[model samples]
Target chain A: SQTIHQWPATLVQPVGSPLSLECTVEGTSNPNLYWYRQAAGRGLQLLFYSVGIGQISSEVPQNLSASRPQDRQFILSSKKLLLSDSGFYLCAWGGPDYGYTFGSGTRLTVV
Target chain B: QKEVEQDPGPLSVPEGAIVSLNCTYSNSAFQYFMWYRQYSRKGPELLMYTYSSGNKEDGRFTAQVDKSSKYISLFIRDSQPSDSATYLCAMSVYAGGTSYGKLTFGQGTILTVHP
Candidate 1:
C-alpha cells in the first residue's frame, strides 16, 4: 500500500522567518506529487506539483516554493513567511494507477 | 465565475438521516468527479469517484454525476455522527497533459450528525 508522510504536524513561526515543510511517499515510484494549502472556506488551493525530480509546476504565485529532491521526497519552502501564509498544508501523491492519497497535513501558524 | 461551485452548508442532521451534498461546475471539459471527506484539522480523504454521467454506489455512499447538467452529488445513507466532516467536490479533465492529475476543488460543505 502507498502512504504519504508530512512533518511538523503543528508549526508556529514568526513573521519574516524562514519555513520548510517536507513530504514523502513510500511504496510507489515516479508518482506525481502535489502540494496544497487549505484555508478556512477558501477550499484547497494547489501550490505546486511535480511530474519528476526537479520538475515543478506552480499553480499560484506566492511567497512559497516547492522542490522535488528525490523520486518520493517533495519539499515546500519559503524564505520569509507572511501572515497570510498560515494555513493547513497537505501533501498528496497520485498517478495513473495510484489514485490519490493525502498526508496528515501540517498546520502552520505565522505570527 | 469560478470553475466549480459548492454550497458551504453547515448542515446538521440527526443520526440515521440521509445526507445530500452537491456541487456545480461551469467547465464542460471536466470529466472526472470525486468526493472527499475532511475532518477538522485533518487532510481530506477520497470517498467516491465517478468518470462521467452515471451513478456509483459503495456500501452506504452513492456518487452521482450528471455531465449534461454539470452537476455532481454525494449521498450518504443512514448518516452517522462519524460522518460529521466537511465534504469537498473536485473535478479534473481526462488526460490533461502537464495539467494531468490536477484537480479543481469547491469550497467544502460542513456537515454535523448528532447522535
Candidate 2:
C-alpha cells in the first residue's frame, strides 16, 4: 500500500517568518507529487507538481515555492510568509491510475 | 469563466435520504473526472472516478459524467451523518507532457446529513 506523510500537522507563525512544509511518499517510486492549498470555499488549488527530482511545475504564482530533493520527498517553502499564505496545505502522490492519494495536510496560520 | 463550477451548498438532509451532488465544467478536453470528500479541516479523499462519459458505482455512491453536456454528478444513497462534509469535483486531461495528471477542481459543495 502507498501512503503519504506531511508535517508539522499544524503551525502558527508570525508574519514574515520563513516556512517549510515537507511531504514524503512510501511504497512507491518515481511517483508524481503535488502541492495544493485548500481555502474555505475555493477548493483545492494546485500550487506545484513534480514529475521527477529537481523538476517542479508551478500552477499558480504566489509566495510559495516547491522542490523535489529526493524521489519521494517534496518540500514547500517560502522565504517570507504573507497573511494570505495561511491555509490548509495538502501533499498528494499520483497513483498508477488517474486519481491521487493525499496526506493528512498541514494547517498553516500566518498571523 | 471558471474551468469547473460547483454549488457551494451547506445542504441539509436527513439520514437515509438520497444525496445528489453535481458540477459543470467549461473545458471539453477533460477526460478523467473524479469526486472527493473532505471533512472539516482535513484533506480531501477520493470517493469516485470516471473516465469520459459514463456511470460508475461503488458500495453506496454513484458517479455520472456527460461529456457533451460537460456535466458530472455524484450520488450518495442512504446518506449518513458521517457523509456530512464538502464534496469536490476534479478533472484532468490525459497523462503526458505538461498536463500530466494535473487536476482542476471545482469550488466544492458542502453537505450536512443529519441523523
Candidate 3:
C-alpha cells in the first residue's frame, strides 16, 4: 500500500522566521508529488509540483518554495514567513486511478 | 469568475436523510471530475470521480456530471453523522504537460448530519 507522511503536524511560528515542512511517500517510485495550501473557504490551492528530482513546477507565486531532494521526499520552505502564509498545508501523490492520495496535513499558525 | 463554483453550505441534516452537494464549472476543457470528503483539520479524501459526463456510484455515494450544463453533483444516500464533513468538487483536463493530473477545487460545502 502507498502512504504519504507530513509533519510537524502543527506549528506556531513567528513572523519573518524560516519555515520548513517535509513530506515523503512510501511504496511508490517516480510518482508525482504536489504541495497544496487549503484556506478556510478557498478550497485547496496548488503550490508546487514535481515530476522528478530537481524538477519543480510552481503554481502560485508567493513567499514559499519547494524542492525535491530525493525521489520520494519533497520539502516546502520559506526564508521569511508572512501572516498570510498561515494555513493547512497538504502533500499529495498522484496516480492514474484514484487521482491523489493526500497526507494528514500541517497546520501552521503564523503569529 | 472562478473556474469552479460550489455552494459552501454548512448544511445540517438528520440521519438517514438524503444529501445533495453540487458544483459548477466554466472550463469546457476539463475532462475529469472528482468529489472529495474532508474532515475538520484533516486532508481531503477522494470519494468518487467521473470522466467527462454521466454518473458513477459506489456504496452510498453517487457522482453526476453534466458537461453540457457545466455542472456536477454528489449525492449521499441514507446520510449518517459519520458522513458529515466538507465535500469538495475538483476537476482537471486530460493532461497538463509537467503539471499533469493536477486538480482545481471548489470552495467546498460543509455538511453536518445529526441524529
Question: In order, what is each prediction's RMSD in angstroms?
Answer: 1.3, 1.3, 1.3
Give the residue spans of candidate 2 off by over 4 A.
B97-99
Model 2 residue pairs with clashes? none
CA lDDT, candidate 3, residue B65: 96
lDDT of 1 at B74: 96
**Ordering by lDDT:** 3, 2, 1
Residues B1-115 of candidate 1 have per-residue lDDT tens digits of 9999999988999999999999999999887888999999888999998887899999999999999999999999999999999999998876656535778899999999999
Native-interface RMSD of candidate 3: 2.1
Candidates in order, TM-scores: namely 0.97, 0.97, 0.97
A1-111: candidate 3 lDDT, tens digit per residue: 989999999999999999999999999998899999998677999999998999999998999999999999999999999999999999999943458889999999999
Question: Which stretches of candidate 1 lie above 4 Å from their native place?
Answer: A96-98, B96-99
**Residue B14 shift from truth in candidate 2, angstroms:** 0.7
Q: Where is the poorest 10-residue window by lDDT in model 1 chain B?
A: B93-102
**Candidate 3 chain A lowest-lDDT run of ten:** A93-102
Candidate 3 residues lying further than 4 Å off, grouped into runs, are A95-98, B96-99
Per-candidate DockQ values are: 0.57, 0.59, 0.64
- Candidate 3 chain B has its poorest 10 consecutive residues by lDDT at B93-102
TM-score of chain A of 1: 0.96
